[model samples]
Target: MAVLVVGGSGFLGRELVGQSLAAGHQVAATCLTQPPDLVGPAWHALDVRDRRQVADLVTAIEPDVVINAAYRKADWSSTADGAAHVALAAASAGARLVHVSSDAVFSGAAVRYDETSVPDPIAPYGAAKAAAETAVTAICPDAVIARTSLIIGDGGSVHEQRVRALATGRMSGVLFTDEVRCPVHVADLAAALLELASSDHAGIHHVAGADAVSRHELGTLIARRDGLDAAALPSGRRAGTDLPGPLDVRLDCTATRQRLRTELRGARQFLGH
Candidate 1:
């Protein structure tokens, strides 16, 4: 299938592009700044927020699938500008739309959220993403919305920095042991997304790591894996408050697994543990 990846230059987008290319699919990616060297796809200088440009590009490519992974903020957003444009463009081009969403849309109060959870976003970014989810589904009924959680990998993430700080004895604060999260590695997430692109699973789907761990535990594990001092880092509960969102952010991936025909694994395996 010919696929167009909007915001194909970001961290997750890079992984998606690489995975799609490796799967022997025709890919076209767009970037705002530096477009990376995509092996199996042509890179285009496209901006998703600009309606005319997005429309022109989509119409020209006439892609069978359009994966919208572009977002202004990784965590929060108050405006739905980027999301709206992508949805509108996808509808205009008559392509199957796949919108990347987040588990942040949920308040994280539920122990495990399915695709049916009503979004109660506490942050601006979460609110905007939720809005995008509604708009995309309404505009394009065939659109696929994948809501994922904290992304983990070796390629520069918030968790990686924290691990580095403690390993190098540069830690200044305690890790949050109370804040639990299910972090999916970018590579695994990409693989699942590719599987979804070829399936008929339309509507919202939650994607996250199989195992959920507290912030402190995750940090400790990373330290242990790298042969660093796990005891050197402080507990993440210095503030004595659960994270603003759900304490246990595990997702029910039954639908995702059924469609992909494979179970998604947790983030710990990325360290080869």
Candidate 2:
């Protein structure tokens, strides 16, 4: 099958491109800036915030499936408006869509969320993601809205890098013991997303890890895996801080898990003790 992966330069996006190539699929990928060094995908310079550009690119490629993994945490135009543009283009091209979402849409008041939970975002990023989800759902009825969490790789994820930086005193920040999330491996997430894209399943699907761990605990795990000093990785609490976000948001992926052939391993399982 021919596939289009948006945000090909990103950590998760890179994995998606690689996996698609390995599956022997004809792949086209888009990047906001320069394309990556990966040789398999046909690369395009796309600004998803630009509706005409998005539509034109999708029109030119005419891919069978479009998997949107593009997002900017601080920019609403990139996160929300971009999603709508991509959705519109995919729908117009009659292509299947799998739009990636985040567990940040939850406010943590419920603590644990499922596919049925309504988004009640507290921060701008979360709100933007929620908006993206809404647009994708309404625009593409057959699209899969896969809401994942804290995508960790072998060592390439931002969070994992942050942990390494903190342990070596290259960065200065405390991993909040109270802030928790179900972190999914990048490979697993990318594979599951591809699996979902190829399937007929539609609507909201929670595709996070099985284990819900605090940021500090997650950092310690990273440190352990990387042979860093776990004690040097400072821990703190986000509860009393001025941070405007959830303290604990764990997605319940039981229903989604039953439908997928990919195994979404937990951080502990993937990273080890």
Candidate 3:
């Protein structure tokens, strides 16, 4: 099977590309700013925001599976509109699509969000993601929208780096004790996404870690996992502060667990206690 991974240079995208290649599948990857470090997959320069480029690439590649993982912070055109373009192109070309989404799509009003939970985004990023999910579903009904959370693994993710900085005294800000998320390991999420690319399951799926933890707890866990000073990381609350949106967007992955054989382990298991 030929697989096409958009945003192959990104943290999670890179892992997907590598895993796809290791699984002996023909892989093609796309990037905008930085080129992918691996040499196995075929690389292409792509800007998903451009409809023509996306269509042309999908037409030319004709991949069996196309995973839309491309994202840009604070760029609606790239994050939201780009996802629509990709979904349309994939649907037109008759390729299966796996659209990566975030847990931020929900406003933390509910105790826990399931696949059927309605999106009530409060922040700009969350709103954009919700819009992308809508566009992708409307454009391609068969596409799987994998809603994941804070991706951390092997000391490379942005969340882990921030915790590291705080532990080392390079940055001085308390992590929020009120804000909670189901932080997933990048490798586990990547594996599940690849598996879903071939499956017939469609619509929104919560493909995240099993445990829901607060931001402060997550930071402290990362600090301890990396042998850093966990006590140095201070804790804060999101109740009174200017922080926007829902404070606890915990995802329920029971549906995902039944769908795939991959185990979406929690941070405590992956990072170790």
Candidate 4:
């Protein structure tokens, strides 16, 4: 299978590219700002927000699968609009699309969410993700929307780095005791996504960790894993914050487990006891 991974320079995108190459698939990856550190896959400088560029690239590659992992932190045009462009381009080229979405699409009103849950995004980022999902599905009905949670692992994940910084007194912030999420390991998510590239599974699929934990617990676990003092990490609640975000966006991965052979490990298992 020839796979084209958008945003291949990102944390998750990098892993997907590497795993795809290892699986003996012909891989081509795109980068916007940062260049991918790993070798083996063909790399291209691409900005998914550019519709013509996206269409031209997809037409030229004509890959069997196109994985849309491109995202900009809070940029709607790049994150949401870019996803639409990629999906449309892939669909036009008759390529299978696997769009990576987030649990943030939910407003955290529900304790647990599944693939059937409706999107109720609260933040701008979450809204962008929700928009992306909608556009991808509308443009390409056959596209697979893999909605995952906080990605954490050994590859210097941002979540772990923040916890380490707080534990070491380099950063002063409280880990939320109220905000709960199912944080999946990067390697596990990457493997599942790569496998899904060839799958005919359409619609939204929750591909997340098995365990749902509070932010404080996740931070403490990451601190302990990095040999930092877990007690040093402060905890707080997001309920009374000025700009409060989602409280609990836990995704149930029962569908993912039944569909894919890849095992999505929980953060506790990845970080150890």
Candidate 5:
């Protein structure tokens, strides 16, 4: 299969690109600035915010599947408009689209959300993601909108790095005990996405991990796995703070899990805690 992984330079995108290449697919990737020593997949310069640029690239590649993993927490154009552009381009190219979304779309008022749950975003980032989801769904009704949670790699993820920094007293921040989310491993998420891409499944699918854990507990797990002082990690509460996000948002992946061959293991299992 010919696959186009947008934002191939990102953490999740890198995993998806590598895994797609490993699966013997003809892979092409897009990035703003080219990454050095990137092997296998053909790289293209793309600004997903530019409608014409997105359309031209997808038209030229003519990929069988397009996975969009591009987003900026603060940039609305990149997260929302970029998604719309990718969806339009993919639809124009007659390619299967898998738009990566976030559990942040939910406000966590109900705590646990299923595939049928509507987005009630609170923060700007969550709102951007919700807007992206809306645009993707409207543009490509056949597209799979896979909503995932905190993506963690073995040791390369930003969250893991933060845990290390906090444990080592390098970063002055606290992992909130009140803030909770389902954390999915990058490999599992990438594999599940590919599986969905090859399948006939469409519409919203929750693709998060099996376990929902608080930020502090997750940090402790990371610290323990990395041989850091778990007790040294500072802890706090986001409830009373000025933080703009939900306290607990758990995605129920029961339906999605039944469809996927890939097992979405919990953080405690993957982190080896």
Candidate 6:
């Protein structure tokens, strides 16, 4: 199958492009700036915000599947317009669209959220992602929406910075033990997405690690794994309960396991524990 991956320069996007190409599929990817080391697929400089450009690219690639992995940088705004534009373009080309979303769409109140769970995003980022999900599904009912959580990999964005801070003993004390999340590996997530794209399944799906870990626990795990300090530095406003609303977002991947017939790597296992 031929596939088009948007935002192929990002952490997860890089892995998806590599994996798809390795799986004997024709892959075409797009990125804003120069992408990381990519060899197998055709890389095109694409700005998803430009609807015409996105549509033209997809139409030219004529891919059997289109994966919308691009996202706007987290800022004060709370909407994912670029990602939605990719979905719109994919739908215009009549290609199967796969929209990557976040577990943050939920309010994080539920102990376990399934595909059927309604989105109640508290943060602007989550709200924007939720809006993007709605747009993709409403436009193309056949499009697959995969809601995942914290993605773990080497030298990405969030995880890498945290590790660096710990190594330098510059890690602040503002840690949130209240925030619980399931972190999935980039490779595993790409595999599951490929399976879903190859199949005829539609609607929303939750793909995540097998277990949930609190923010403090996650930080400590990464610190210990990398042989760094795991002690509290100093408590700040961000350290207390008044910190950004912590969500206990643990996704239930029953449908994903049963339908795709694949096993997801647990957070501890993925983190090299």
Taking the candidates one at a time, how many backbone clashes does each contain?
A: 5, 0, 1, 0, 0, 2
Error of 1 at 31 (Å): 1.4
lDDT of each: 0.78, 0.96, 0.92, 0.91, 0.95, 0.79
Q: What lDDT tens digits, residue by residue, belong to model 2 across residues 71-111?
A: 88999999999999999999999999999999999999999
TM-score per candidate: 0.89, 0.99, 0.98, 0.98, 0.99, 0.90
Pairs that collide in candidate 4 are none
Which is superior by TM-score, 2 or 6?
2
TM-score of 1: 0.89
- Tens-place lDDT digits, model 1, residues 5-100: 888887888888888888788899989888876566788987666778878888899898999888876433312667777788888878888889
- Name the weakest run of 10 consecutive residues (lDDT summed) in model 2: 237-246
**Which of 3 and 5 is ahead in TM-score?**
5
- Model 3 regions lying over 4 Å from their true place: none
Q: Return the TM-score for candidate 6, rounded to 2 decimals.
A: 0.90
Tell me, by lDDT, which candidate is best: 2
Ranking by TM-score: 2, 5, 3, 4, 6, 1
lDDT for residue 76 in candidate 5, whole number 0-100: 96
Q: lDDT score, residue 237, model 6?
A: 33
lDDT (0-100) at residue 138 of candidate 6? 82
Candidate number with the higher lDDT (3 or 4): 3
* TM accuracy, model 3: 0.98
CA deviation > 4 Å runs, candidate 6: 75-79, 154-157, 171-173, 232-245
